[model samples]
Target: MSESVAGREAGSGIPARRLWLATTLILLIFVLLLAAYLLLRKPTEVTVPAPVAAVPAPDPAFATRVRQLEELNRSLEAEIARLGRDPSPLACPPGTARRAEARPPQTPAIA
Candidate 1:
C-alpha cells in the first residue's frame, strides 16, 4: 500500500494510524477527567433523623368522646337493620329504576 507524507492513504481523507491515535488520546483524556472528578469530588454526608415517639399519651376525655361516638354509630346501624328495604321511593321518575343500562361485554380485537 502507498502511504502519503500526512500519514494517510492518499485517496482516503482519514488515516488509520491517526484515527487510532486520536481515539486513544480522546479516551485517555476522558479517563483522566473521570479519575480527577472521582478523586476531588466531596463525599456525601448521610443524616439519620432522630427517632420520634408516637403521641406520648392519649387524653382521657378524647378517649371517652370516641367511645360515645362508637356507641351512637352501633345504635344507628341496629335501627337501619330493623327497617328492611329503603322505605322511601327513589327520587327518579316512577316507571324506570334509576340504574344505567347493562351493555354486553365487548370482544377484544386481535392485533
Candidate 2:
C-alpha cells in the first residue's frame, strides 16, 4: 500500500524536492540581477553654478529715492504713534461742539 501511494504521488504531481530547487533557482537569479544592477548603476553628479562677477554699483538716483521713502515711512510711523495715543474718536474733532451749537436746532423726526 505504501509503495502504491508513493507511486501515485510521484505520477500525480511534482516532487517537493524539485519544487524547492526550482524556487531556489528563481530566487537566486533575482538576487543576482539585483546585485548586478546595484554594482553597475552610474553615480549621480551635482553641478554648481559659476560665481558671478563683481556687482555693479547701485544707481545714485535709486539711493536718493530709497532715502526719501525711508523718511516718509518714519514720518508716517510717527503720525500713527501720535494718533494711537489720542483717546478722542476720529468722527468728531475738538471744534465740532462749537459748530454744532452755532447751527439752528432741527425738529425731532416723527415716529
TM for every model, in the order presented, reads: 0.37, 0.45
lDDT of 2 by residue, 1-111 (tens): 999999999876767778999999999999999999999999899999999899889999999999999999999999999988887574656555555458766899999
Give candidate 2 misplaced runs (Cα > 4 Å). 1-36, 39-50, 89-111
Residues 1-111 of candidate 1: C-alpha lDDT, one tens digit per residue: 344554554546547668999999999999999999999999999999999978768889999999999999999998898665556454556675544776655999999
Alpha carbon lDDT of each predicted model: 0.81, 0.88
Q: What is the C-alpha RMSD of each candidate to the true structure, in Å?
A: 17.1, 8.6
Off by over 4 Å in 1: 1-24, 28-50, 85-111
The model with the greatest lDDT is 2
Highest TM-score against the true fold, candidate: 2
Q: Candidate 2 versus the native: TM-score?
A: 0.45
| Total backbone collisions for each predicted model | 0, 0
